[model samples]
Structure formats: C-alpha cells, structure tokens
Target: MAKKAKKIDIRSDGREFDELREIKIQAGVLDQADGSARVDWGITMKRIAVSEKTYNKVESLREQFYIIPRGKGGKKYLVDVPAKLLDKIGDEFGDYEVVGEHFKGNVAIVAVHGPREPIPRHVADPYRAVLRFRYTMAPFSVPERKRPAPGRREIEISKVSREALQGVVFANEYPMTAIDIFAELLSADAGTRVTAITAASVALADAGIPMKDLVAAVAVGRAYGHLVADLTKFEEDAPDAVDFPMAVVPRTEEITLAQMDGRIAKKDLDELVELGIKKAKEISALQRQALKEKYQRVVENEQ
Candidate 1:
C-alpha cells in the first residue's frame, strides 16, 4: 500500500513550510573558503564551504611544497551525460580553473568546511590530513527539547561519518591541516550525512584544492515493505525498519562505504544496496550537471 503525505495545519498565509523540498546555492556565504555557500534542507539549514592555505607564509616544513611539511592521502554520471561520463568529468576538471559550489537540501542544512591550516600538532598522523565531522542541534530545533550538551552517540556518529567522507577527500595536499566539517542540524530529517558529503565537495573545490573527482551519496531504507527516497526520523523510528546507509562516487560506480544496522534479512540488505546505488547515481548525475552549469555561469560572469 502506498503511504500518505505528511499533514500540516493550514493557515490563511499558507501552511508552515509546505512545499516540495529543493536545494539551491547562493554565493558568498563565507569568504574563508575558496568556495562556500548556505544549504537549506527543507526544514533544516547549514552554511558550508572549503578553503585552502599554505603551510607557512614562511616555508619551514620538514619537506618543501609539503603543505604540512608532510602529509598523504586518498563520481558520477548523468543520463544527459554521455556513456563516457568519467572522461567528461576529467575533461571538465582539467579545462576548468575552479571547481566551485555543489549544494543540495532535504529538510535540513549542511555546510562544507576547510582543507586549511597545517597539520595540527596533535594530529601528527603524517600519512594523511584529518577529515573531521561534527553534528550540533540547535536547542529550539526540536519541540520542547532543552539545549543539551553533545553526547557520546553524536560523537561516535561524527567519527564514522568522517570515515565515510575522508574515504573520498584528497587529504595528501593539505598534509598536516585538518578539513573540519561542521554539520549543524537546525532541524534534522534523516540522510543528513549524505547531504553533508554532497556539500563538502563543493566547498573543497571552492578552496581550489585539487581532487581526482566529485563524490555523491544517498540513503535508501525499507519500512513496512515500502522504500523511501530519503528517510526521516519519524520513519526511522517505525516499528519495522532496517537502517541502511551507503555512500558512493557515482561517476566511478564505486561503493566506498555502506552499513546496515537494526534488523534486516539478506533479501532486504540486497534491496537496500541496490536501491542506494541507484539513487546515489541519480543524485550524482544531477550534481555534475549543476556543477557544470554553475562553473559556466561563474566564468561567463567573469568575462
């Protein structure tokens, strides 16, 4: 059976936030990032972008041109894109000077942050730059919820999310610097992590950091035998559900990270994986198209 749409109280002025959720990019949200913008995910909101900087306006690194004096490291298609989408993205990257502004929204917001600052003294892990994830919920975001301090669960999720994000980020150039992403959930709906990743890449490009490709991700879930486009907290809490989250770079047809929590059978797992891959590819294609258009617009304006 098909599910009904969410209901809201109507007002003369119109229902509160009643409309199809859409993602749009507004320029110049932040100056620090080589590229930056604000993301409005239906009911949620976030501001994010990426920035790049030198190790030392001085050059005291253990190695020359090594941003940290040391460091080490680490997409998608469109139906509109040709069968040679991989070749196409590469061509675009090479021909383009700035790979800027990638943003999408759900019911919440997500922002991408930096590839700046030399490696922190604490993160002496020389082989790679650190990709960090943080999740903070505004006190008034939810109903009757007091502003509470961050708990262990949020911290754990942040670490795992970083793993998913870093899997795609090129940390070597930044070396000692940390790329810290702040995801403030003004009103979280679900699929926030995927949105975070989608936005983070745009910010990275704005920072003008070199990257091999663009990354895109999505979450597909099963509840009561029905599949959902993007899950929300309400659906996630349903009595019968299997939490499946997956991240992929569509252009490459590569699945970098996936996890299935809660109760799920093999058949359900297969379904989730299949659905996730399908949707992620679709989302990736849109990002590529949007980015190409965005890049072109920025260039035309410059000319």
Candidate 2:
C-alpha cells in the first residue's frame, strides 16, 4: 500500500500559500510634492487584553503598543501586541478579549518632484525626459537603526526601480526635462524594494505623467517546501527559502523588473514568476482605487 503524504503546516502567520499580506495605499499624501503616495503593506497581529497592571509595566514603551480602551466605562486597557511575545504569555493572563489590532509591516512614502529642467544640462536627453529614482530608508526603519547614508543596496534598488518605471512613461512628451521620484521607507519588514516601486508608480500617475499602465510589484518564492506569494521576513529567513521579486506592467503583461535570491529548480522558477504576475494584477487594482479615492476626497473638499 502507498503511504499517505504528510500535510504541510500553514505558514507561521497562518496565511495560505498564495495569500498576500494586507495592503493599504493612499495617494496625494504630500502637499508640497507635485504628486505623492504612501503604501502600508503588512499583516496585523491579534489584539489581546491585559490587566491594567500589565499595561503600566509596559506603558513607557509606547512605541511598541497601540493602546485602546475596552470594556464598559472604558475600564479595561487593551493593547495591540507584537506576535513575537504572544507565545510567551499564552493563557497566563487569563482569557484576554480581542479588542484592538497591531499592525507589523512596511510603510513607504513616495514623492514626485518635477517634469522640470534636468539639473545638469549635459545629462538631459533631447528626445525624452530623464527618469530618476531615489530610495532611502529611515534610520529607525528596521529593528536596528539603519545608517542614514545610502548604501550599495539602496543605490542598486534605485537603479532598478528607475528602469522598471521608465518604460511605461511617455518621456518623449516632456523632452529635456527630468521626472524625479523619491521613495522613503518609514518602516520596513521585508520587500521594501517592491513596496517602493509600487508607490512610485502611483506617485508618477498622480503627477499626471503619461504611462502605458501602473506598474505593480510583489515578492514570490518558496519557503518551507511550499511555493508561496508575499514571503514575510520570517519566511525569507527560512533554511530553504527562495525569494523572487518581480514588477509587472499590468496592461501589456510585461515584466519590468525581476530579481531572485537563493536557488530553485527551473520548473519552480517558472511557477514563481507566473504567481508574481498574477499578484501584480491584483496590486494594480488597489493602485487604481487609491488614485480614485484621492480625487474623490478632492471633489468632496471643493463642495
């Protein structure tokens, strides 16, 4: 008799193999910039109620918890807690009520400066506008305070990001000019490059730059023996992890950016790329909705 196959366990965060993290995007967020957008891409861990006593002990660590009032007369203090500590406290604090939510994810803000004259006249292209992308992470963006300077990784990401969006843009319309995109990562967990690219696309559109389509991006890979979409840091650090990040132009189904880390079979690589394209289309829809909402807000304000 053939032996039954063992079932693979759910992801560490209890997500399906093809499930993406929750994403929230807002356009036209920066008043000074010609166009701007903010992308919050991450998962929300559970909210648990702890005694007022526990709250007091950790109250000084305000940065970590989001405090919410629960119960009648707002007597109970509920805090959105991180998942790392969830396993340690289990059942010891009595039956805690789920009252608040704690989000752990990446937050990126992108601003588009101009279709103005290029800074160095020599670098300007006579036939098409020059596209430039700058990607930076805040000092406090990671668990450890990252250095403020742009490192090699940042430079590489900026180069690839500029390449990714340059194709979709109708640069010929604004010759002898430069369109500059600045992407700042206020918080990061993983997939920072992809998040920045996604936000930059929206910021460009918000600036009224002509484009073939909004470029959408996502990271897909294999973790724990299963092909997955949107690998979290936990999955990215797995012993057998394979991370592949791709950006796509949804209208023509053209891949603008593709990068991979670690190894996988050819067949698996093909499957992963297909999964990335599928997820990119879903992200494209969200980008459109965010732009629509921004204009809707504008209309409401005018009235």
Candidate 3:
C-alpha cells in the first residue's frame, strides 16, 4: 500500500497563501520636495501584556521585539511578539492580555524633484526628459549597520527602478530636463525594491508629473513547495525558494520590470507572473487612494 503524504504548514505567520503583508502608504510626506511618499509594508505582530518581571527576562533582546509600557506608571509592559517566540513565553506572562499589534517590515520614503535642467548640459536629451533614480538604505535599515555608500546592489536597483517608471512618464512634454527620484529604505525585512518602486510611483504623481498610469510592484515566488504571492524573508531563504519581483502598469497591464533569482518550472513561472500582476492591481489602488487623501487634506487646509 502507498503511504499517505504528510501535510506541511507553509506559513507560520497566519497569512493566506495569496495574501500580502499589511501595507500603509502616505503621499506628500515631505514639504520641501516637489513630491514625496512614505510606505510602511510588512507583517503585523500581536502585542502581549506581560508583568515587569517577565519583561526583564528578555530585556537584553528588546531590540528584536517592539517593547512598550502598557499604560501610565509603567506597571505592565506590552511586547510585540513574533509567532516563534510566543510559543516559548506565552505562558510566562502573568494574567496578560493580547493588547494590540504592531507592524514590522520595510519602511521606504521616496522624494521626487523637478523637471529642471539636467546637470552637465551635454547629458540632456533633445527629445525627452531624462529620469534618474537613486536607491539607498539607512545605515540602521537592517540588523547590522550598513556602509553609507552606494554599493553595487543599490546601483542595480536604481537602474531597474528608473527603467520601471520610464514608460509611464510623459518625458516628451519636458524635453532637455531631468526628473530625479530618491528612494530611501528606513527599515527592511524583504521586498525593499518593490516597496521603493511602489512609493516612487506615488511620489511622482504627488509632484504633479504627467504620467500614463501608476506602476505597482510585488514579489511572487515559490516557497516550501507552494506558490506564494509575497515572499517574506523567511520564505525567501527557504531551501527551495524562487524569488521573482515584477512591476506592472495596472491599466495596460504592461510589465515594466521582471527579475527572477531562483529557478522554477516554466509552467510555475507563468502562474507566478499572473499572480504578481493580480497583486500589483491591489497595490495600484492603494497608491491612488494615497494620492486622493493628500489632495483631500490640501482642500481641508484651504477651507
């Protein structure tokens, strides 16, 4: 007789296979820039109230968790605990309650400046404006302090991001000029490039730049023998992982950027691309909503 296959639980964070991590975006976050946006994209972890004695046990590792006082006087504490750690410490807290939740993921800020004259007059194109993108990460973005310099990875992401939005911008309208986009990752878990691209699109719109449509991006891949819509850092590091990030124009469904890191069957690749496009549409809606909210705020301010 054939043996029954054992069931495998792929996701430990309780997210659906096709569901994306919680994402919050705000446009016009910076006043000095022509346009700016901030995106907080990541998972939400439950905050549990614990006694002061219990909190002290993990004080040395506080950086890894979101620790805060439950209320005034600092009698009790609330820690945004990860799923893995919950199993070990869940019983230690004395009469604790599930207080709330907090987000832990990539935080990206993007600023857009100008349809101004290009630096070094000779570099300006006669027929269309040039698009320049600068992608950088804060020194404290990751667990370890990163060097404050543009490394090869940053340079490559900048190039791809510039290309991703090039097709949407009406560059011909402002010939002999430059549109500079700056994206900074304040915190990162995974999918930093996609978060930057998503924020940059909104920043450009907020700057009043004419564009065909907003570009939305997401990463879709296979993890633990299952096809996933958005791969977290845990999934990306899986033994049999395939990380494919793509940027798409929602209206026309044009693929602006496509990058694959691991190998997969052709059939699986097709399915993954389709999944990415679907997720991109959802992201596009959020981008539009953020722009609308910014304008609404302006109207309220004037009133």
What are the Cα lDDT values of the candidates? 0.51, 0.84, 0.84
For each candidate, what TM-score against the reference? 0.63, 0.83, 0.83
- Quote the positional error of residue 197 for candidate 3 in Å: 0.6
Residue 94 in model 3: lDDT: 60
Candidate 3 lDDT, 1-303, residue by residue in tens? 112222235353446678888889999999899999999998867777777777676565442223333442355676666544455445645677676766678999999998888998888999999999999999999878999899999999999999999999999999999999999999998899999999999999999999999999999997766788878776676667789999999999999999988878899999998999999999999999999998798899999
lDDT of 2 by residue, 1-303 (tens): 112222345465556789889899999999999999999999877677767766665445332222232333266666654453455444434556776566778999999988987998888999999999999999998879899999999999999999999999999999999999999999998899999999999999999999999999999998777899998777787767788999999888899999999888899999998999999999999999999999799799999
Q: Give me the overall lDDT of model 2.
A: 0.84
Which segments of candidate 3 are over 4 A away from where they belong? 1-7, 47-101, 301-303
Number of the candidate with higher TM-score, 1 or 2? 2
Model 1, 61-152: lDDT tens digits are: 21111011122111211111111222323232222222222222243334555665634468745777777767666676665783668888
Candidate 2 weakest lDDT stretch, 10 residues? 62-71
True lDDT of residue 59, candidate 3 = 61
Q: What 10-residue stretch in candidate 1 is worst by lDDT?
A: 73-82
In model 2, where do residues sit more than 4 Å from their true spots?
1-8, 47-100
List, in order, the clash count of every candidate structure: 23, 0, 0
